[model samples]
Target chain A: MVMSCRDRVLAAINQETLDRPPVAVFTTCDTIGMMKASGASWPEAHSDPQKMATLGCAQADYFGLESVRAGFCLTEEAEALGCPIDMGTSHSSPMLKGHRNKYDPMKKIYDEPNDLPDIDVFLNTKRVKTTIEAMKIMKKTHGEKYCVVGGNTGPFTLCGHLLNTENLVYSVWTDPKEAQKWVAAIAPYCKAFGQALLDAGADIVQMSEPSASTDILAPSDFPIQSGQFVKHALGDLTGHTILHICGDSAPIIPFMFDTGVTGISVEEKVPPEKAVKIANKRGALVGNVGCAMPLYKGTPQEVAKAARASRDAGFNVISAGCGVPIGTPDDNIRALVKAITG
Target chain B: MNDKKLLKELADSVVACDPNRARIASEEALKEGIDPVEAINKGLVIGMGVIGNDYAEHKIYLPQVLVAAHSMYEGLNVLLPAIPKGDLSDAKTAITAVVQGDVHDIGKNIVKTMLTAGGYIVNDLGKDVTPSSIANTAKETSVNVVCLSTLMTPTMDSMQEAVKLINDNGYHKNCIITIGGPPTSEKFAKEIGADHRDDDAQSCVKYVNSKMKKEVK
Candidate 1:
């Protein structure tokens, strides 16, 4: 009845033999209610390596999440890139409002990347450094046990977060070539970022691109600007590469596979069968869990039902389709683990 | 310029979301002395209404809706200014949010904007809205309708809970409560006694029109 949660998840990751598909209890901050119930705290994880690893391990121990992602958002990189975050109620990641405000459409757009942002995010920032150190610590704590996943905003997504998609979409249409230049810059950064994660002992490197999803851009738009750079980033990435995009990504999913993403994680809006078809034709299918279901209001039993559906649907890893919502219930976390294990 | 073909063309412009074309279309209708209301009702409003439906059905996305609504508004801008604003008794008022225990704000924001451009005055109760707060807003704002949203299935019960409170408070008497989001459906709304259910922002306008016309029992 009891086996190592880490092994179950890693087996799925390796695409090896498995009793049941591994379910990742997505590590978005637990809901206020659940946090209060578990008596858990944050800022400790954000600031301390040991506490952060403890936080990461706690989710796995409690819920049987096969994989543990950094849980930090892309705003971390944007913040280093000179964007100030609103520090909204919960971990408000910074946004690049300044550059976006007077963005000129006709001018040559460049990702305008520099090593400075990377240095700050990876070495200087207390929170950033602490996050990396935590991964190292979690590696020591559970590395031999489970797969530690690392996430970063895809370059295009980071750019969207910077310039705001309101204008970003316009730029995509008007200055397509300039946009490519901007996207190209992020590829090296993404590659570097992924490398940093792998070096930190992450078994999986998750890179989500909000800009490439069909919900955002058409398939016709993929080949030129966004998809090419992603292909570049994917080629250089070590370990398993996961491409996470929001919404129904059925149309552009094939292109995602063409880039050789080791796996694809999608939201509930995207049918699991579609992803399964794609995965069957290509690589591993990671998820399509309703972020709100287990992470918000659903009980352990409901989580089990959802997991059973995922198992039936052929999802290799049970993961929320999107980032876990803030304040998700702990029992629900227990339920998510139960779903994967039971 | 007030050609019917031109007006229809203008309406199509709204659907394509080209405000300049929409403006040209609206001006032609007015110059031809078309009944401003009829021009709006038949030309721009009806077309944009379709986009909202398309959005609900996932036939169209947020960007398309934004463009279509923007086009409709440009047409409205041409007409609203030209004609002495008459009482368009068809105005709808909606209170929307992501519901409590949820923090997603984009879907609610897009839907609200579309509804507002559709001539519905919307009060965004903001993300993570509690049921009691939603009920209170309905009571206090004299809102014509309550629109509850949640992108998560777990928070869906919150929508049901909000709808129940509205009924319990007798706020459902004349007011139509509409709910939609990633997990919501028309059928789900009916199961919970919600007066209206739309998964997309566009269809709600038509539903709103139907509700406004219904006689109070």
Candidate 2:
């Protein structure tokens, strides 16, 4: 019997024997081909749930990726929390331009933790509302066939977004306690937003904490700066949770498991054999594809070869280690799916 | 205050990430009549060099690097204005900007910091800078080098555009165009007709500094 995408993904997360290894892309995979196919792209896709759903569906619908996730960018939480956004063009994801308090938005948050934007205000923001609506649409359309994944910025990254990333990084050393408090303050909001994503019918919720990667945060500090806060933000979600840290994360893979996530997704920096060995003791593993290198620069044949190597190396769910670059060709994505299916 | 001792203390202050100590060391170097430029290169830049090396090796992370850069800025703020204008008038100028449509500037910012720390007069055009703006700034500043940065592949076309614009502006012959970021490579640099691409800030500093030396000779 053929397993549904939802079942295959959940089985991988639960470490159950599967009919076949699941293939998914945890973060943004909306290529320009996807945009053209849906007639929905960024800037507009960012604001319109219908367009967002249409673009998001193209991944699973057209390319045969087992999972589909909406909200193609990480700016939702920041924009909701009062950061001014530059709604980018068809090729670029929206970006946070500035905060409400030009001088020190983060300082303002730290000074008045109680005065941070209310939960109601966060939910009412344009992007958040539409993001939830997009998830709902995906669930309605592809609920039985594919896994509908949704995500929010993990606590540390969310704090980094609200405050400037530079300030947030410095604060981790200079003011560890306040930095923890700042992230802790937003944990509830992240949890609430994640639960909303589930309510909208997502099977798995991913928390991308690229800021907490070993490239940015010391591996030794991962437990507090990332692991504990990830738990704080996502502990209450009813669905399975996946954690993604953007760079080579081998050293902190064990600590990441301690956060109670069902799976950990990694970039190409972590060797597939190493990821498998680490996950054998921890949890499910996903990804090691080079999103920018071969997928963006090389041919579909290269992507297929990488996909086969990643599969043989024991990635539980085959995927690109980072978000699929916006310029990644459609043929490459199709090749990725074909390699796994073959 | 022996010059070598004062410079050592200045470097130590920055490595320790103590802005107050950096400021104090800079003041003492000035009071002792040390050449501010020498103090900056020998002291502050040395500290940043240590920070840069640590970052490249993954021994230090973003938090430590950010703090170290802040400390260096504190020291530079004291020394930069005191130097006579004509004394460093021959300093090589470089224009740096994030390619158009790419707002990710952390890598570019770090590169700018290291370039400035390496004694280059850097004109930072900030984020989402267009190709025409970068080419225009290069022409107006009469810069010896132009560095383009972008974190996303979709926006890399803008890096090529900036290169073409620089050539169109007649600055290509004199200016060394370089691109840096995670997605960029030496092959991509060559394909776009750029002079160099290095993922690390220190290498970028080394490249420009070496070119500056050759030009002077």
Query: DockQ (Cα-based) per candidate?
Result: 0.19, 0.70
* Model 1 chain B lowest lDDT segment of ten: B83-92
Q: Write the per-residue lDDT of candidate 1 for residues A1-342, one digit (tens) a residue.
A: 665666776666567767788777433433444334434445344455665566666656655567665645555666555566543333232223344333454243444444335543544455456556767877887888788877777777766665555445546655666567667765766666667778888777788786666655656777665778877786457677888877777777777777777877777776777678766646667776677654465577876677677778888788777777655676776676677676
Highest lDDT against the true fold, candidate: 2
Name the 10 consecutive residues with the lowest summed lDDT in model 2 chain A: A100-109
Model 2 regions lying over 4 Å from their true place: A101-110, B215-217
The candidate maximizing TM-score is 2
lDDT of 1: 0.67
Chain B vs. true chain B: TM-score for each candidate? 0.75, 0.95
Using DockQ as the measure, the top candidate is 2
- CA displacement after TM-score superposition, residue B121 of candidate 1 (Å): 4.2
RMSD in order of candidates: 4.5, 2.1
Q: Please report the TM-score between candidate 2 and the true structure.
A: 0.95
